[model samples]
Target: MAHYRASESKREQFRRYLEKAGVMDGLTNVLVALYEATEKPNDALDFIKQHLGPGADSTDAEGSRVELSELQHKYDLLLEENKELKNRLLQYEPAADHRGVE
Candidate 1:
């Protein structure tokens, strides 16, 4: 009984390690895909489809949803800043435009 328990514990540990490794591999693959997409999105999609199994599309979709949400938030902030800069530019334009007349 003691020997069997010891063997079983070792097996469980090995399985856990394997599972962790697999997750790590998946994450690495995802990062690589993102990098590839940055350069060539269609190629990246093809690579994901070839390498990431049938569920790859769903996984990529979820990842894209998250990225899009973040990008939208950033874009809103940038648009606000752009508006502020344009207002500032307009303020300067009136003074500069009047300088020659004065």
Candidate 2:
């Protein structure tokens, strides 16, 4: 009975330590996000890493990815439009005088 109590006490101490360090809250939030994800990630470990890995302070990994993709598409479209506009402008601009002779 003494041995059992000792083990239980150790476990409790460890749980408190985790809670005090904010590990419990962080993990709980991550798990809840994963559970609510519409499209499950193929790699569960990778998903966790993306949310909890280095430089990862946010929990909405999926949302971030989607936003990034949308931004990239918009940037591409804008770049193409800018190129077209520049080409059109070039057609009207006066040609540069290349001859140095007066």
Candidate 3:
């Protein structure tokens, strides 16, 4: 029982961090709490229905999921862009190469 409580505490801490980081909204917070409580997504959906009042509709949940997906997509694109930029910069010729100063 102590271990279960500790795990629950950790999950709560993670949830709080996620909220404070602005990564999710109140409805999504309830969704995540449901997820943590049941470990099954269907159970999480049910929990959301019970706990999230009128905000547990498919549209809102889908919107949150889409936002997370889009953020991930943007992050991937930025990483690729940064890598390409770094490679391009690394390929530049030094001034010494043109002057033959060595």
Candidate 3: list runs displaced more than 4 Å.
Answer: 1-55, 93-102
TM-score computed on alpha carbons, candidate 1: 0.38
Candidate 3, residues 1-102: lDDT per residue as tens digits?
999999999999998998897657876777667657645664555666676566647788899999999999999999999999988886785554466645
* lDDT for 20 (candidate 2): 100
Q: After superposition, which runs of candidate 1 have C-alpha atoms over 4 Å from their true positions?
A: 1-56, 95-102
Query: Scored by CA lDDT, what does every candidate get?
Result: 0.79, 0.89, 0.78
Clashes of 2: 0
Candidate 1's displacement at residue 95, Å, is: 6.7
- Best model per TM-score: 2
**Model 2: ten consecutive residues of lowest lDDT:** 93-102
lDDT of 1 by residue, 1-102 (tens): 999999999999987897777965875777686776656665665676666676667878899899999999999999999999999998768766466653
Which stretches of candidate 2 lie above 4 Å from their native place? Answer: 58-102
Number of clashing residue pairs, candidate 3: 0
| Superposed Cα deviation of residue 54, candidate 1 (Å) | 8.8
For model 3, which pairs clash? Answer: none
Q: Which residue pairs in candidate 1 have backbone atoms (N, alpha carbon, C) closer than 3 angstroms, thus clashing?
A: none
* Per-residue lDDT value at 10 in model 3: 100
What lDDT tens digits, residue by residue, belong to model 2 across residues 1-102?
999999999999999999999999999998999999999999988888877787485547677888999999999999999999989998888557853666
